[model samples]
Target: MEWTAAPARLATASADFEADFAACLHWSAETDAAIEQRVADILADVQARGDAAVLEYTERFDGLPADSVAALELSQAELKAAFDALPPAQRDALQAAAHRVRKYHEAQKKASGESWSYRDEDGTLLGQKVTPLDRVGIYVPGGKAAYPSSVLMNAIPAHVAGVQDIVMVVPTPRGEKNPLVLAAAYVAGVSRAFTLGGAQAVAALAYGTATVPKVDKITGPGNAYVASAKKRVFGTVGIDMIAGPSEILVLADGTTPPDWVAMDLFSQAEHDELAQSILLCPDAAYIDAVQREIDRLLPTMPRAEIIAKSLSGRGALILTRDMEEACAISNRIAPEHLEVSSRDPHRWEPLLRHAGAIFLGAYTSESLGDYCAGPNHVLPTSGTARFSSPLGVYDFQKRSSLIEVSEQGAQTLGAIASVLAHGEGLQAHARAAEMRLKG
Candidate 1:
């Protein structure tokens, strides 16, 4: 592996650092457009043919049999069997993770409000009302790689938000649902679980099929095709952010261990080749040790080939002037996972303004937030944390502004409304206010 030591200050250094930073932000407009076209084609087919189109696409893409729509739905007996099939230890761990996730999301539920009156030369009542979505669809990736954690993260929040119905869809490999995924769906309080996935599943959720009910929103991570489908069906049904490859930025000082840093970097790299694992440190010797540790640890990992390719291709060990510069680089990257492994993480916490999730101290690992930690692992990726947010209970709820004007209040505010409406050439709007004022 090649190790390039970044100078203390890029202002005084060569042009290499600027070049590498620009390469990191290489957004491909062409690639986005191509993916969008494919998604649009899939959506149009599904809309025209309904379940028949969904079945054909599932077989072609997911390597699963195009079974009957009725067979796709999981029965109560199957859910019970999933819970019974697990060993006591695994079951306990899943339950514990579910508890923490539920506790965190439950606290995020928006509460209903009553109308409040304010004096407007007279009196007027105004407030906001919070209501939960009627139904929601959560996509959980299945097959060889089962993400039971995703089931907990997506479903628990909708449940906490008091959504009336929750439908979960997962790709069953060769038409078989993983027992662990089934158990997670049950534990997370999902009203329905379907063995369907890919772009077809997204389409079914967006435009209701005979078997699957249309949902108010869909939330979860999937492959590129699934993401594109969600983007295409956005106006038809709400969607979570378009997540990209996972990323982890570790801001460490000389106090941290090289092995811990190397392993954490590998954790994200194994997710995908495009996944970025970057380390920014003030100490040059620490960077050297981490690079060496990565070499030693790569062979021991199960996904060593993947880790090696990702680290060598997308990973970097950037040496900064000080902790301030290190934090500045982290903000620029806006990584999905940010780890502050310095001596005093609390002091550096104030400097970190743009990360999906922040891990403090050497003890906190990004893996914890992915599974057991209370925070949602479904975070904004690809530098989107600058504007978007992590998934939460608020994603499943809608709010409406409530307004109630008394007769005297309408009379007092009518003149201003009339003036604005007249200025804008909205004669009907002025007349409505005038009628209320006169009444």
Candidate 2:
């Protein structure tokens, strides 16, 4: 069968541009009611029954029958063996990626993850105390594909942030464990590893089982069931943002090769049918070249069918009035990955804001960032990039405000606190402040 992938074409000056553009960007984040109900039932059952529920769900969903949860656990020695058994090239690549990730996060920790303090003239010391969570659970998607990159991205940062315990959960269908994932866990310092998935794994992480210890936060991507489970278990344990489909919006000035941009779009489109890939350029000729390349190259791709469906369904190749207009539209979209494919990327970069990650040059493909670019690939998807951030060292750490009020400082602060407390009609709060005040 012949396959074709044609994105919706639009011009900024068209009369129906606004309506069409909004329609193109529309994606409901809502999960099916049945999935939500199922996830709720699973969460409740796991929370109530603990290890037995997890074991049952693991067997039922994954077809990996386990007599006990302990039988499902992957020991440190097993993880190390997985790493050692890898081919020389695979081992080198995994170690290299882990090194870069660790270095980047260590630098991140130094920049914003560190504690700081300041002393006022009145001798009041105000500061912040930075500390890592006791433990964290990272859920790596193992159903459709195994992502060793995710293992590195999620666990390395927690390790760098001084998190004492990092629990990793990956779904291994029929007890088929991905060696690379296990190797990554070994390299990234996961304290515990489990072959568990779906809402049951999330419940075990969030609520804590007799075997799987509860985590302070759960971070990583998953299917609909996992996303819904994370949303439901938010207050019980902190969670990273609920991500949506992958997205890539390229802002081009017709300088970069059209084939490069086409392949970049394909990189995201191949993820799933719902993933979005878009191109915004002022040059009409360049837009045509990209579409031509996309059609010419689609047949050569192994995942061509998936790419075709994704591009046909959600992709767009928009022709803007100018690069500035493209930048404006990109900001509105707040894409998960924004590629500034231009000669002077920096010029347009300052104009662009609200992207999960920006690929700043022609040589910098979004895929590089996904693998070994020394940055987090676990980014905010859909349009959530407008307010959310990529997972980082800061995500693994918490802060406590430190205020040391001197006798002189207490008097001034006490007076202000007493007035505010009294104004709010809380006599007990007012009295508490008054007690600290100097007569």
Whole-model Cα lDDT per candidate?
Answer: 0.84, 0.95
Runs with alpha carbons beyond 4 Å of true place in candidate 1: 1-14, 25-36, 110-121
Q: Write the per-residue lDDT of candidate 1 for residues 285-343, one digit (tens) a residue.
A: 88889887887777778777777777766777887888998899889888899999978
TM-scores for all candidates: the values are 0.93, 0.99
Worst 10 residues of 2 by lDDT: 430-439
Error of 2 at 414 (Å): 1.6
Clash numbers, per candidate: 0, 0
**219, model 2: CA deviation in Å?**
0.4
